[model samples]
Target: MKRRTFRAEVAHVNRPLGEALAAELGVPLEEAARLVDVGAVYVAGRRSRDARTRLSAGQVVTVVLEEGGQSPLAAAPGPAPTLRILHEDEDVIAVDKPAGMTAQPTEGRVGDSLADRVGEHLKRTAGLVHRLDRETSGVTVFGKTPEATTALAEEFREGRARKRYLAAVGPVALPPQGTIDLPLSKDPSRPGRWRATRAANGIPAFTEYRVLHAGKDFCLVELLPQTGRTHQLRAHLTALGAPILGDKRYAGAAQAGGIPAPRCLLHAQALELGHPRTGAPVRFEAPVPEDLARFFAAAGIQAPSGPIRPLEPPA
Candidate 1:
C-alpha cells in the first residue's frame, strides 16, 4: 500500500497540538485529538498525541493512518509478526526492536511494523507510543490505551524518560565525559536525511556522551540524547570528529574502509519510563547485536565483563 504523503506546513507557530493538527488536516478537534492519541500522527517521526503540544512553524508532520482507525490505509493483515517482547502489562508493552525493521510501515512498504507485531502479541488492543530508527536495535515501548499513551507521551515530552545508547566508534579521541551541543538540520543536499549544520534555522540538539571503554582499534561510547531530534546522535558524533564506525550516511570513511558491517555501529541500549497503568517506574534493555559482537572479535577486543545491564533511570 502506498502511503499518502503530506508536506504539512505549520502556519501558526507553537499552537496547541489539537488546534494545530486539526487545522492542518481540516478535521474536527475531537477527531484529530483521537487520531493523535492513538499514535496515528507523528511529529518528524516521533509520536505526538497530545492535543496541547505546541507546534513550531515549518515542522513537517507525518500522519500514519492506523489500520483499524478511520483513515485511508488498507486493512491490516492478521497474525502480527513475531517480536521479542521484553515486558508487558495492561498499561504498556516493551519490545526489543531489531535492526533493519522499521518501527512503522511507510509509503509502498508492506511488512510487519513494530506495532503490527505487537498487536498480534497483545490480547487487548495495543498501540505504539514511541519508536526507534530502523537501524537502531533496542527497547521500544507502547501504550495499551489513550490514557497510558498520553501519560507516557508526556514523560517523553518533559524529557523525564531516560534513554541510554551504546555505540562503537572509530578510534575515539575525545575525553571520557563530555556533551555535544550542536545544532542540526536536514541536509539540503539529501531530503529525508539529517546533518549537523550551523545554519541559523537548525534545531537545537544536545547529546551527552562518555567513553565507557577504549580498546585496540575501537571505543565503546555511551550516549544520552537530551533532545529527540532526527539523527541527533549520528549528526552530533560526526560533528564531534568521531562518527560512528559504520555510519555510512554521516561518516566519511565507512564505505572506503570496507567495514565488515554495512549497518551503523549504534545501538539503543536501554529505556526507562513510568508504567502507564500503575505509575510505577519501569525499564528495559537489550544487549549488543551479533554484528557488533563480531566486529569486536575481529578487532580483538575483550568483551566487557558482566551481563548486559538492565535499563535504569538516572540516579
Candidate 2:
C-alpha cells in the first residue's frame, strides 16, 4: 500500500466537519467520514470520529491518504520506527523528541520525519504545533486536531507558554542571573546564520538566563526567551561572551584543551502549557540526554535541582 499526507489550516468555519475535510482532500463525504472512523483525520492535533464536528477558523487539519485502498478505515502497519511519548490526551500529545531529528518531513526524504512517526502512533495524522532545533532535544507538542493546533500556537505567540532550556556555555563574563536584550536578524550576507546587531531590520529578541552551575571555564545556564526567533538563545549567549559549548557554528571552538564536545550543548529540558482541551496547566520535563550528561560530568557540574520555570516574558 502507498500513502500520502496533506495538511491545511481550517479555512471553512462553522461548516460540517465532514464536508470541510471532504472538500479539502478532494474525496467524497463518505470517504471523509470513514477517514474519521479510522482516526485518519485530525483537527488541531487530536483525532476525531465525528463527521459532524464543527471546525474553527485558523485550525489545522492533517489527512493521510492511502493511494490504493479498498477501505478508508482499513488499518495500516504498526507505529513508526521510534518515538518516546511523554504525555498524551484526546487533543494533544507531548513527545520526547530526541536530538538530531527533524520536527517534520523534509522534501525528498522518505518515511523518516518525526511527524510521520507521530501519525503512525495516532493511527491518523498528527501535526507538529511547535518546533525544537534538531540539535536541541526535548519535549515537543503535537495537536491531534486543527483546533488544538490553533489554540496552542496562539499561546506560544501570546507568551502564555513557558519553556526552559539548559545550555553548557564556554568561558565568558556573565552575571549570576540577568537578561540579554539583543535585536536579531538573519545575516543575508552570511546566509543561515544570525547576527546580534541592531541592523535596522533586526527584530528585538529577549532571553533571560541564570547560572545554575558555574566553574572557572564553563557554566550550565538556564534560558527563557521572549521571542521564538531562529537561533535566539545561541546568538544572545554568544553576544554575552559565552557561546554554547560544542556549538561550532556560533562558538569558535568545538573543543578546548583536553575536553571534547560530542554535540551541541543545548537541551530543551522542560515545557509548560495550558491544556488545549481543559485549560488546566501542565508541565513536562526531559532529563538531560547522555551527551549532555557527559558534558556535565566533565565540567564537574550538576544539573539544576527541582522544576525551573520561566521567570519573565521575553521583552
Candidate 3:
C-alpha cells in the first residue's frame, strides 16, 4: 500500500502530540491519537508511540497515513461496552472487566476501554489505578477523584496492594507452590513483547504460584505478583515451562483437557488494598466468567471456592 506523510512544526509549548497532529491534519483528537499509537507520528524525526507526548515550541512533527485505505478520520466507532460494577463509593470504583476489552485506549482503537466505560457510567472521568491485559477478565479498580487516584497509585507502586490471578495452564513439572524470581526485559527482536532474562540490567520480577487444581492434562494455578512489571506473570510462567493456556504470545498450548482454548485462560480474580480515603482495608472479587467456568467444568477441575491465600509472606 502506498503511504502518505504529513509534516508540520509545533507552534506552541507543552502541547500534546495528538492535539498538534489533530490540528495539523484537521481530524478528531481520537483519530490523531490513533495515528500516534500506530507509530505513524514522529517528533523531530524520531518515531513516538505515546499520543500524550508533550511537544515544545518549534519542534517538527510528522504523520504518515496509508493511501487507498480507510482513513482513521473516516473510521466508525464501535458501540459502547458496559462494565459490571463490583464496588463504588465517593472516592473509588471497582468493576468486573470482561475479556477482549482493554483497560485503556490502545493502538488502532478508540474508546471501548474499561476506563472509558467507567467514565461513561460515572458521567465523569475515572482514573485507572492499574491495567489488565486485553484478554484477562476480572476485578479492576479506578479512582473517582484526583486525591484517590494519587493515593491508590502510590499503594500499587509501593507494592502495598495485593493482586491475585487465576490461570489454567498445561501440565506443570515445578513444585505445587513456589515463587518465580526471574527478571524481565523487553524482547528487542519482538516489538511489543517481553521475556524473562538473566542479564544484569533486567528489571526484577517475582510471582508466587500455588496449584489450585490438577487435572489429567491441565492445572489451575493461583498467582500472586509481588512486583507490577509489564507481562511479568505471562513471562515468568512461560519461563517455568507452563505458560498460560491460550496465551499464544507465550507459547501456551492451544487446547487444554480436550477443550479448545478461546483466549488466554487467565483472570484477575481479586484485588485488595486500603481504602484511599479512609485507610481501611478494602477488597474486590470478580466471579469466573463463562469461558473459564466452562473450561474448568469440561476439564473436571473445580475452581477455588474463595480467594486463594498467598503461599508466602505478602510483599
Candidate that beats the other on lDDT, 1 or 3, i.e. the better one: 3
If scored against the real structure, what TM-score would every candidate get? Answer: 0.67, 0.70, 0.76
Candidate with top lDDT is 3
Q: List the candidate numbers ranked by lDDT, top first.
A: 3, 2, 1
Global Cα lDDT for candidate 2: 0.74
By TM-score, how accurate is candidate 1?
0.67
Tens-digit lDDT string for candidate 3 (135-190)? 89998999999999999999999888998888888887767788899999889887
Residue 160, candidate 2: how far off, in angstroms? 0.4
For model 1, the superposed segments whose C-alpha errors exceed 4 Å read 1-81, 123-125, 252-259, 295-315
Q: Quote the RMSD, in angstroms, for model 3.
A: 6.2
* Candidate 2 error regions (>4 Å): 1-81, 108-111, 310-315
CA RMSD of each candidate after superposition: 11.0, 10.4, 6.2
lDDT of residue 235 for candidate 2: 85
Per-residue lDDT tens digits for candidate 1, residues 1-315, read 223334445465777767876777687988778766655566665666477877776666666554424353244344544688877777778888888667875533334567666766776556676778877788888888889888999889988787888777777578767778878888888776687767647989988877776765667677888889888888888887778777777753452223465688777877877777677777787767786666556656644433333335445
Clashes of each: 1, 14, 0
Best by TM-score: 3
Looking at model 3, the pairs that clash are none
Q: Which run of 10 residues does model 1 get worst, by summed lDDT?
A: 302-311
